[model samples]
Target: MDKLHAQRAPGRPKQNEQNIPLQEIILRQAAFLFMENGYEPVTLQQIAKICKVTKASIYYYFENKAELFTASVVFMIQLAHQSTLRYLEEKDDLRTRLEQIAKAKMMHAHVDMETMLREANPHLSEEQFGRIRKAEIDIHISLAKHFQFAMDQGSLRSGDAMFLAHAFSALVMLGSRKHVIEHNTPQEDLPQTVVDLFWDGIATQPQHRK
Candidate 1:
């Protein structure tokens, strides 16, 4: 009986410790599965199996599939926001910073949360969809602030900061596709090439050419 008690006591603490990270693990794995298979095809059972947890365990963290999907979008955007903050802190020139941002976007292209959400739109509530859209807009606003800073520093031409930011983001998004990455453009040179094309078009004069 003493041995049984000891075993049971240890098991509870071990279970608690394991449970602590399960929510995040679920979000990450769910995001990957949703991105890989889209929302319609992915089942809670599949997510539970992949996370080695029961459907009840997932329900403990999220109310339903839509909630889980929304939370996963938030999780991914938060990560990207943190990365953007770190990249913006570097002392590099504007072009270099933009290149790094583009490269980072390329690295994460496989995640494609926006596309996945669009494909799964019918399954999501307006509130859930709005949450994801707001997250994306927040990122765009952050990037626009950076563009405004670059304009002030004369690293880029003076223009509508938000518009420039949108254009730059669109360019990065296009470059992030697998087909674009695998094209004749070498991976190492792609980000730099993208930056050069963007900056050259928006830069002030011949002296701005680099």
Candidate 2:
């Protein structure tokens, strides 16, 4: 049978492979608008105007606001996964591994999340919010497994997985604070200090527990 004559999968559109470029362009612009302005305030008509397409064209890809928001979140997660996986695979030592994880997470969070969250907060329904919360939790849980692996490899001290996961994530999210002239700390020095504290200690090495 001819490929075109073959039945399409149920509920799935016969998407053109090359058209993905256009889809991504539209989604990227839409995601940015949503992140900056928010889903509740932005309509498909607005997105179309920004993307320079008619409302009819926007409807060809996404059905509604909810679907578009969900797709944007999924896209962000996918990009994060790709970046983390690539960096994590390259590091050799456990300390290096942890450092890479922290740096990668921090870089991504700083560059990406604030706007994403600002928009997502009001636009999402209760169920959507809960689901997103769980998805983020699961991402942390998966990261925790890597920390546990480091411990098993005798790189990090043995400890609670969930606690460590939450701790590491929080540290990255909170970042580090330091004074400039008063403290003489350079801007570049702060993140390295964060990495050191996770492995070393706030106090001297002699006083710290393994």
Candidate 3:
């Protein structure tokens, strides 16, 4: 048996034996399962099986399925936020940066909120829901700050930064929908198209002749 396995006790596992990479593996697998098959259908056992660990090992890190699910979602949100930050850091104009952000979001947009909420087991409490909402707000604030910077640089039209951030986020989310993406929008062209649509608007530009 492994040293970590040998260190396990009857009731609880040894905390010191736990490793970060292993924990992250469990979280990733759990998050994938939760997104692929709704939360209600995924079990600790399933996560453990996918991670090649025991159910007790999973419980050593999480108290129950709800806790595990919450942790997985939090992990994914943090990753998405980090990716967005990286996209914003790229040396590009506001339109290019926004397109990069949209592409990043699209890559990580497998989770569906309505379906996840409906299938969530043990039903998330108000407090749990609040935590998720706060994570989202943090992302919003980060994006809003980026938008404010772009506006200051005169790259984007001046408007309420917060509202523009939310609108931009909504547009990115819209791109994630299967129906919207299935209409032969080439993968490479989709982000640019989204940016152009937002920047130029549906109405004809004054510079363009009929």
Q: Choose the strongest candidate by TM-score.
A: 3
Q: What digit string (tens of lDDT, one per residue) describes model 2 on residues 1-210?
A: 435324433333333456656567677777667655655677888887877766656656666677777676666556666665665567576567667766665543322344456666676677766655665676677767787888898877899978987776666655622221223434455566676876676777457348
TM-scores for every predicted model: 0.81, 0.68, 0.81
- Clash pairs of candidate 1? none
* C-alpha lDDT score of every prediction, in listed order: 0.77, 0.63, 0.76
lDDT of 3: 0.76
- Write model 3 residue lDDT over 150-190, tens digit each, in one string: 88988777999999877777777677764244746556666
**Residue 50's C-alpha lDDT in candidate 3?**
88
lDDT per residue for candidate 1 within 55-128, as digits (tens), equals: 87777667789889888877888788788777877898777888898888776666355578788788889999
For candidate 2, give the lDDT of residue 122: 75
RMSD (Å) of each candidate, 1 decimal? 7.3, 6.5, 5.5
**Which candidate leads in lDDT?**
1
